[model samples]
Target: MFEEHGPPIEFTAAGDTPEEQTTNLKIVRPSPGFDPASELCAEAIIKDADVTVLDFSPQQVTVRFQIDGLWHAGTPMDREMGDYMLATLKQLAGVDYRERRERQTGNFASLYLKKKQKFKLVSQGIQTGERVALYLDYKRPPLDKPEDLGMRASMGKQLRAIVNDTNMGILMSTAVPGEGYTAVWRGMLEATDRLTRDFFVMEHVGKNEPEVINVYPVEYDSAKGENPMTPMKQLMLKEPDVLAFPDIASGKLLDQIVSHSVTHEMPIFTRIPGKHCLDGLLRLVALKPDVKKLTDRMTAVISMRLIRLLCEDCKIGFQPHPQMIHQLGLPQGRVAELFKPMVYQPGMVDENDVEIEPCSNCSGIGYRGRTGLFELLMFNDELRQALVSNPRLDQLSAVAKRHGHVSMQMEGVVMIAGGRTSVEELQRVLKS
Candidate 1:
């Protein structure tokens, strides 16, 4: 084998080895002293973090973990070791590490604790240095049902009523990306009367979820230029009762769906992305479908956003001033005690002269997990008329308020007052 005065095929190895490689494929040997756990992660960290970040700089790599939408710092790492770790991880994730100036994404899977963990790795260059971020797909528990998604009891009833309707209309579930849009959308699909009614779902081939009981899940080869509509065209030959699919990105498809639902009296369920219920609704309306037809054919929009739950053990309940309550748009005398998180002040010591430890439950972050706040915007005659008369958001919102569509803001206040979450967390989520 010829030694190189040039690059030796860029073979990667762990940073603990200071000696450089002399030939291509020379770093393949793993002996008794090699331990990958130190480079990638520990068993406990794999269970704790929903997202992990390794931000590199000239001097060091700052490690951070995101739990329930909040970032928690991990121990700092040495720069040389961090760079080696990053390069090895990038190669394992199938991303190019040479071009660190450009953004790259790759997928990696690992089996830890007998469960398959899928990670989406994103690495990019920055002005000062480079950074790598990873998201844990399996960290989120399954939102298998309406209650699991944290829907209020009353809102759940209203949604079930919409799903059980015999009349033809469009029922949409909207949430921003990564905000449980799939849960709401698929929950709507699963809530249907699939036993008696022929319910079907269309997704790209091989991307369909596990088959639900009594519901037909179909797929099309998008690589072959066949989509959900392609199979639906042939399926229409049968007496298909209802249809469900994802992605409303295509205007032609939206128009076809609206026209088909109205003309054939078939109900359809789908999802879209936005900040809240009205936000998602208006985005669809902005697509410029027939106002009258959409108003007539659309049944309801169930939209939602997430709110972090305070740690039960560490949350401090305090009396809220009436002025503070009113400032938060809360009704007078409605809330007596409100909860807030306890911040660890530096140099605070216990009776034994030992530094006070942060809350064990939330790791001192004061919030453990998150739950959803939902807005069910049902289109009754008044709301439908309101849409036809004034599709403008303000005019429609005024009418929606009169018809008992509780906005997520109001719902969040309820959650805050109930001690389920804190005012700070509520503000952060709503502002987001």
Candidate 2:
């Protein structure tokens, strides 16, 4: 049985310092006859790390934890302990524990720190031994209200107007995986007046099933003779005022969706994977090959990426570097200070006269939460006409910019200037 505790345990990275590494090693190592796997899993949950990967080798087992979208190394274990941990996880996930040479996947729930947490476990055999990945389903607070989604006031107004527009069109949410595109789309759905308009969704799996929206589940199984498009067709027959699907990938499905949007005069909300708004729209055109139909019906494309926000309690303010100011195109003397995730204060010494430690508020991570950086491209008459004729991404992007479409890079720059995040953090996400 899992024990519910007061709060989650905070685990320091093994590579932080030699003394800290030794301390963490002792903490992670299992006691005699006790299961180390369970202890480690519990510790990870308590620490708020949502993902764990364990690699088994002849010599030892390596553990890594994913925190805030980055992976950090954890303490290692001996082969015996590693085997025990793998077997324990397999059993808990209800997979084939005895068959170690095949791939398997399963899900299980546990009570950790007084919360019911779910985990998906996957195991695969390798030449060395086996590799196992455990993905925790960390529940996030609802951002149902559009105001809570961190959009600028002006942008929020525009988005609301677009959503409430009576004309039927296709609205797209675009971002790379893990970029909070789904959350943004869900929030948009919530912004709709559910009491009046009928909203429906089709998805392979569902999360956070809102009461107002009707969701139809779809599964793709060739062996079981399941057609993925059947559920989609069924959902279309209902003729919802607003229809949503998780993604637009298959060419055939994309064509059908476009056709429905045209014939039924209903707005369809879907997502596509892209780094930019124009890139996503271009991909959609490639999928359907009906540029005029898509460009005419498409209303807007919202591109977003989640960036870590600096902890207010411990962030330190500093003057901008000369080059950074120039790179951001800011008037050099006007902007005074920018903030960085600072953990320590001056003259804060330890018993040995060293710096005491990082800020307790952020656990020395320098960031507490994340906020979205959005770039919205709302199509206008000019953009639609340009797309129909040229179908060139560069030309379309120019028109979008002329029509007040902000790029993701510019959004990050604005955030950095406002001291909500640091330039280094922005660079980390943008890789520029």
Query: Per-prediction TM-score, please?
Result: 0.79, 0.75
Colliding pairs, model 1: none
Per-residue lDDT over 130-243 for candidate 2, one digit per residue giving the tens place of the 0 to 100 score: 888889886788776656777787887888788777684988888777677666776667666666677776654434445435443444443554333456666666666877
Model 2 clashing residue pairs (backbone): 8-46
What Cα-based lDDT does every candidate model obtain? 0.73, 0.72
lDDT of 1: 0.73
Which candidate's TM-score is highest? 1
Cα deviation at 382, candidate 1, in Å, is 3.3
Put down candidate 1 lDDT per residue, 272-363, tens digits, no spaces: 88878788878887777676777788888888788888889889999999888987888888678999987666577879999987776766
